[model samples]
Target: MNPVFKEFKEFVNKGNVIELAVGVVIGGAFGKIVTSLVNDIIMPPIGALDRTDLSGLFISLNGTFYQTIKQAKDAGAPTLNYGLFLNSILDFLIVSASIFLLTRAFIRFQKRQVEAENADKICPYCISKISINAIRCPQCTSILEETH
Candidate 1:
């Protein structure tokens, strides 16, 4: 039991685990934000321009008119809520785009870090700062191992 508890604590304390938990929470909040953006901000203007509320674009299997989607679902009506689906699709696209852009930025930052780290350094043989130069080291009689 103590070992199990210790293992659990270690698992929770791990950087990846903590990051994953934070990501999940942030992702949930981001999902809600995207949903609101799609429903309230983006879709509203589009709906206004198209002359139709997305919520109203539902077909009932039975002959029943619903003011809202919640009411339609509550009344046990089979509805084809294509407009809501479109809104959801837009939300997904926005989220996907945001994630893609973030990942791309992260990758670019990592590449920059790597390039900075792997930049010109002093040659071990020559003791001179060189940008991957010196096939034969200038100061010493050693051939550079970097060159074939």
Candidate 2:
């Protein structure tokens, strides 16, 4: 095989490349779900209670009062959609919090794994970490008790 292809194969075999790609795909789908939750489910009740549509909440630059964004756009007027900006801010906060929680959980899991691996015995004489299965301390060459 070619050297470049061999190196590429090694890189792909490292596992994280595929996982990262999958994460990206899943993250995109999650973003869509959050967007739908905010726009379709969460905003409707708030809009109803306030007696106004959240999506249409905007300010027209043409100094004309419009009931909805549709009216402003129909008149060829530019608008500042502060409501949409607020929605985007909410989405960002939700995603960041979720990612932070996931990262914390992953770190905790990694620490548990490290502690499990460190369950090996420590040599009494030299105080060096040794395998639990060791019959003698490899560092100090001291005899160790048997497992029976």
Candidate 3:
């Protein structure tokens, strides 16, 4: 194999690298789902309630009136698309909240796993931490009798 190809294979074979690639793919798909949710499900009722089309709300800088953003852009007019900006901001907030919740859940799970592995008892011989279910002190190799 070519040196560059061999190096690339090794890099791709790493577990974390594969996991990261899967995460990026899933994140991109999640973004599209959120975007569709915002545009289709959330925005219509919101726009109706506000008595304004959220996506169409923009200020024409060229002093030309246009019914839609497409018309304005097609006419070669500059516009401040604050409505699109607002939509993007909403998308960012949703994604951020989702990532935060996922991270929090992952942390809680890790804590549970650690707790199951490490316990409150200190081994008398070595003064090292051991699991509640342990039959022996791992550090000192001292046999233990269940107090309970």
Backbone clash pairs for candidate 2 read: none
lDDT of 3: 0.88
All models: lDDT? 0.82, 0.88, 0.88
Q: Tens digit of lDDT per residue, candidate 2, span 50-140?
A: 7876667799998999988888989999999998888898788888888899999999999999988877988889999888889999999
93-137 per-residue lDDT for model 3 (tens digits) = 888998999999999999998876655677777888777777899
Candidates in order: C-alpha RMSD to true structure: 4.3, 6.1, 4.5
For model 2, where is the 10-residue window of minimal lDDT? 50-59
Q: TM-score-based ranking, best first?
A: 3, 1, 2
How do all models score by TM-score? 0.73, 0.68, 0.79
